[model samples]
Target: MNYLNKLERKIGKYAIPNLSLWLVVTYALGYLMMYMTPGIISYLMLEPAMVLRGQVWRLVTWVLIPPSTGNIFFYIIMIMLYYSLGTALERTWGTFRFNVYIFGGMIFTVIGAFVAYGFLSVTGGLTIGIGYYVTTYYINMAIFLAFAVCFPNMQILLWFIIPVRMKWMAYVYAALTIYDFVTTGAVGRISIAAALLNFLIFYLSTRNYQRVSPKEVHRKYVFKTQMRDAEMRHSGGVTKHKCAVCGRTEKDDPTLEFRFCSKCDGNYEYCQDHLFTHEHIKRS
Candidate 1:
């Protein structure tokens, strides 16, 4: 986690904001291609053999392949759900960490494809179209699983009617995934493991487990509600923004603009004059 923090500090500015929206747009484009020019879809798959043969575009273009195509209604619903989940994760984890998690899964999936290809070649097995087995399906599953871990008790309407908690859904997902891995071929198993490896490595290894405990979650929820009520009660008296450095608020200078510092360790804000000059706050 410390290493990740350092890396984020160095290159976090390059991380994409609203990456989920772009991903959804990419899927939409892929869907359009599927309907308009179906043959082009094959050229976009992450086929190792094709890539090695100098069709290197296949390596990156594969991400544009939509996970599934059937009922348009369900597909739209799935895209919206994933977009919400991805946005929540990006907000909670910050852009850089979310980007690492997503890109890490993609890199692993690419490696897994090549690994599977090598194994097949060595074993005198079929090697054509190996990329067909690998898709963003498991990557989407990883996003959902990560969200479940962070907000286990969050409830949503199941099939737009029955209410269900995310943890229960996660359990069902895990069970189904395990069943599929056990029943499917080597390629399928590798694809699943590769895509989900990022979740296991990032969340399980670095997350503060205590923060996810039922008691902790409940306590935080109560505290947040209390703070919200207090803020509401004092809303008329309190200023909306304040500068941590200058100790100034909009009440002090109506023309002053305040902004939160992304480089700071905590939620520190600054007024326009000191925004660039103030030293960032860091916890030891």
Candidate 2:
């Protein structure tokens, strides 16, 4: 376990239920099985047939399957890398967003499998979308890429030879996935689609996507500026809406700012930054 994991455990119970640790544990188990048995290439290796055969569990489980641990050194390296990524994403996105990204990939993989099943049912083409190897892997890569995009300066020791920036590494990983999709058939294609979908979701989910009137935005800025100035004087600033759920000051993000909780119908202070960015609306 990493320090972050331990800290999370000690500080609160939130991290345990998080998808990152579960994914890592699943991968560890898969890798262990693969190591103990040498000849068979099963879902542990991301085979499609096992996935399609109502091994539907693989739909979500395949994500935990580790990359081929060909050698001792490589296995250790991959394990470290995989767990590191899990911890980073868990901390960055919090439990809910991270769960959405992971489970979204699983949903995409299952949908891909069903689509593949439909094609096979009709065209009677070769078996496809057996294991969700591609989907799970790409989802992981997409999350890492998202983290890299947000924190480009983050670094890691690559092959124990050189230090590399995360952004460039993300680009390289994406290119490799594209290359695999073009070269490999079926399963790879599904993975590519799932990964691309994750990226699309992440990209469309930024403050930049907000749409609000310029007057409101200016007011927000002024409000925040005033708040800071007033804080210096130990006095309350001008009125600015604050989210009851998330303590986001609606001083900067004017657009999409929340007010008067629609559900509660009364006092509310949520900014738009907290609304779309959170899992406030439960699916009925």
Candidate 3:
């Protein structure tokens, strides 16, 4: 099995459901805060210098900052677009994998912030706030990129007018990102790289792995053969349902009702006559 499959088996249960809704809610709260008390936002930025001085809440509160603060109409449209993309990704990738992708991007962004802070502190004095540059903007971009990769041919209206495929949109965005990275400063480059690192890793890992590849086909064949063999063994050689207590099966008495004991140590079935009377089995 793949590493992701192993991880899903182990910790998938802890994944948050409807994570996209929560992200939208955070953006809404940030917008409200921006309109109400803009000054408070300075305290919520992901400033590593501030964190070292004990303002550690900046690490998390930075995510609450909206990607943009201009043009309310565009902001609403952007939020709706991302909400749709995120929800679709969650449904396609499953909650746990989607959680990993998002949280991975966020974690990488945090690390990038720290790296940029260190670089600036060593070369020049801490000149400006790194938090301003290292925001969730790239993280949002990563989401769109992932959606594009997953549904490249899916069409959506561009500017609510022209219909365009996801791949075409992704290409445009990618070109813009490349241009931005080339023209921007070191901190901006680092932030962009960090934010999209998750998508990069995911794309590289899955690019060559197709759904109907030879390995997958072999796996399915083996699974089906095993299941068929088990079914044949059960049908041709053994009784379908057998009683552990009375050693009786459906063949012995067609009307016999059998049930596996829930409290039994193992696969112990009993006829209705002995089901309630037999002591529950316990394994050490």
Candidate 4:
């Protein structure tokens, strides 16, 4: 963990990973469905338009639909890969932001589908092939891109031995996404739109969103507290000096060290740990 994270933890704050379980469950279920028969995914699922008509399950289950279910083993491999991607996203974006990336992509694609429907209704439905034919995979890509932009030098295994920089990963994914959008075969294109939407939304919402300097964040809260305590200790009053433990008093200085009493006196000194150095006090 970094310093900022440490500080946040010290303050009893935390960033939770949001909405990742759904992706895991949805895709895993799809993988299971494929084992039973081929084209089962489509059969169990309805086209977006069909869903708009009445098959409401389409609206939700649509996300579980994988790019392609190759073989039993192949889907297993893909599930493992996508899960790795999911974990990376959770760590990079705290729960709150990651959910935004996910739902934002879903929402944008849904909007695109409705918009595409409006156009198709005017004329007729063109074969955009399977999926929404919109770039949705990129929603995921854009989030990774944001993380890469923030931490370019971060390293990851391309495939075990081939060490790669996060920046390269983002670039390579972005190229594939763009190529898929332009080319005829749309493989996981809806994901591209979703990823792009993540980028746009984050960029727009957090144009001013930059990591807070850890020092500044600490000073603002922690240092402010220390200052308040220090001020109270120095305030003008008939300051008394006596040890509640031994009643030792320095009459001349009236500033002898005496730790506060947590019991009877409620304010006399001879702290619970006299031998243990207390850094919170100022010595004459």
- What are the Cα lDDT values of the candidates? 0.91, 0.64, 0.92, 0.59
Pairs of residues at least 3 apart in sequence or in different chains that clash in candidate 2 = 27-64, 48-130, 220-251, 242-269, 243-269, 243-270, 256-272, 257-272
The estimated TM-scores of all candidates read 0.73, 0.59, 0.72, 0.57
Model 4 worst lDDT window (10 residues): 275-284
Model 3 per-residue lDDT tens digits across residues 209-237: 76679989999999999999998887884
Q: List the pairs of residues colliding in candidate 1.
A: none
lDDT of 2: 0.64
lDDT of 4 by residue, 112-163 (tens): 6655555556666552333445432454456567677767898887656799
lDDT for 94 in candidate 4 is 64
lDDT of model number 4: 0.59
Candidate 2: residue 155 lDDT (0-100): 83
The ten-residue window of minimal lDDT in model 3 covers: 125-134
> Every model's Cα RMSD, please?
23.0, 21.5, 20.5, 17.3
Off by over 4 Å in 2: 1-18, 38-57, 132-135, 207-284
Better of 1 and 4 by lDDT: 1
**Model number with the top lDDT:** 3
